[model samples]
Target: MEFSSSLTLLNSKTPFLLEKRILLLEAILEHGSISKAAKAVPMSYKSAWDAINSINNLCDNTVVLRETGGIGGGGASITEYGKNLIQSYTILQKEHTKFLEKLTTLTDFNSGNLKSLQRFTMQISARNQILAKIEAINIDKVNANIVLKTKSNQRLVSSISKNSIENLVLEKNKEVLAIFKSNNVMISTNNVKGFSARNKIKGLINKLTFSEVSCEVNILINDTDVITSVITTEAAKELELKIGQEVYAIIKSSDIMIGN
Candidate 1:
């Protein structure tokens, strides 16, 4: 969907060059004078002279001939070598344009099929991790609800809260990593050491949801997984969670929940 310079050469010895210089050279040859060529190419005379000087430095032969105060009054003309260079460059330019046109046609021809193939490959690979862009953060006195918009235009709603959200400085368009662990996440204090899990995700206590028999605690990790669980409010407070503190959430693949 985007176009960029794709001039790849088979050999490695070619000097670094710009296509615009060749275009300027062609215009100079066509117009027969530096001032006229500058106008024809819509460039300054200094820029045109600079390009000519660069080319002259690269090649063995002088590309342009200048006459001072002639019958036609001090004009410029391309040398024989310069004419040859322009002709070759024009041919290459035409071929390059054709190549790009062909490439575009091929891309359009297979774009739909390529997308379907990519989707099929992704399905076969069973990829679960997705990147989400945080869109809105609503922090209440006791709770916070975070709304995220994913790259694929999917919406995810996460409830956290005032103190914890403020601690992370969660804002609109911030990239927060959303991880889905199993229904239960292992929460341990910094002092509580020893974990076999590969991803020992860390966070701070964000919100507490209490029911008649059970309660849910939300742990906010840095731009990543927000582990939630049913834990006693007293236990949540006993964790000494204010606005910011350190906590760890242990998650195993078996504990990960995946969805389409």
Candidate 2:
């Protein structure tokens, strides 16, 4: 088997520079025109310009300089910073390639479990991430309502756009991670009816944490799973919330996100 890797620089969650953008920058340096560079990179002229603008906005210093009255109306040039960026990226890419090659050799040849590396590398701020299997999918013209079954036999539902269903390639019995934030979960002392939220799982309050403005309630739904909710301290006081008391966790289907 062969291993290859693409190097990218990110500004928080957004990508600042990638292999394709690097190629576009190189083409711009060679051709001296955005239009010619776009053609060389096989990207649209507008996309090339947008990439340049994005790079400039993310960096403290301007990277690409535009020149007027050059043969074809106007042209583009790379700054010293941009040239140094390319060289730095090239060096990093070589090291990245070497690291992946070593990783490939260490991987199990027959199993081909390289994709499993994501489980260790993936990190998010979401407090709840439940492993579930896709029990069913109800699709309409505009959206899809997915039903997921957890290991503890609890069924959770998520509502997503139809385009997302296609993009994620969701199907029955496929494993996925049901993700939601602690703040999005609502706690109820009683089985309240006529609520807009669709999901409700009854459990005992396992723990309670108090802060100046908010309270954290941890509910033990099963032997292995615990769901947490962050609610206002005023609400917690009004409800007289206590550990070991029975309560229900409520969540809206739209608030749940499905990740594979």
Candidate 3:
């Protein structure tokens, strides 16, 4: 059987490798210099340098080093740490292949359903995703109230229709993730009062990025978790938002999506 899948070595928040970068690293080891390695991997010298810089930034230790003025001037080689990472990735690749082989041997495997599932498994365009667990779910005749406790112990409230409660099988103590677009989150520098939105998470402004019309504001909660909101550029300037300023992320419960 022939199938294709990708293996990624990720740090807690960032990807550690793409296969091409790993191939370039492997070429560095075999060819003994960045210039030669670039030619071996058929990559431009500038692209190879950029990959090296990215690799160094991702790791705690310097993974690749440039040597100079020792009979041979200015060449590059992988560090011991980098070599270890390569070996680890090679082992992971073999394990991935074996796992795929085992899957093909299963008798009741449904490829059609798996393919359909893969479509939804793709990364959504939403900018904010918060991992949470259901603390409580309140139900009335028409509406359902859902309470979510995030990993950082921050609380969020969501309201959905009774039909959604039944269809999604809402329950207490269930692990789920909340997804919402940046524009769905409203930002306020002052205390929000008499608002229709159910979720109001207070956080410190970590960063603010501007576009032509809008700006993306990143807020850090409890020094751990982060949520982002998109607000108009004019609003941002009016609020006089700066790094470390306190702000609130307001989200309507109906706007939040619950993913199992």
All candidates: CA RMSD (Å): 14.2, 7.2, 16.8
lDDT of candidate 1 over 168-252, digit per residue (tens) = 7778887654545333455667735575543455567776666665556676656554556555556655665544557775555
**Top model by TM-score, which number?**
2
The runs of at least 3 residues in candidate 3 whose Cα sits more than 4 Å from the true structure, single-residue gaps closed, are 1-122
Those runs of model 2 whose alpha carbons end farther than 4 Å from true positions after fitting are 1-117
**lDDT-based ranking, best first?**
2, 3, 1
Model 3: lDDT of residue 188? 88
Candidate 3, residue 180: Cα displacement in angstroms equals 1.4
- What is the Cα-based lDDT of residue 211 in candidate 3? 89
TM-score against native, each model: 0.43, 0.57, 0.53
The TM-score of predicted model 3 comes to: 0.53
lDDT of 1 at 79: 87
The local distance difference test score of each candidate is 0.61, 0.88, 0.84
- Model 2 misses residue 38 by how many Å? 20
Kindly report which residue stretches of model 1 are placed more than 4 angstroms away from their true locations once superposed: 1-17, 69-73, 108-260
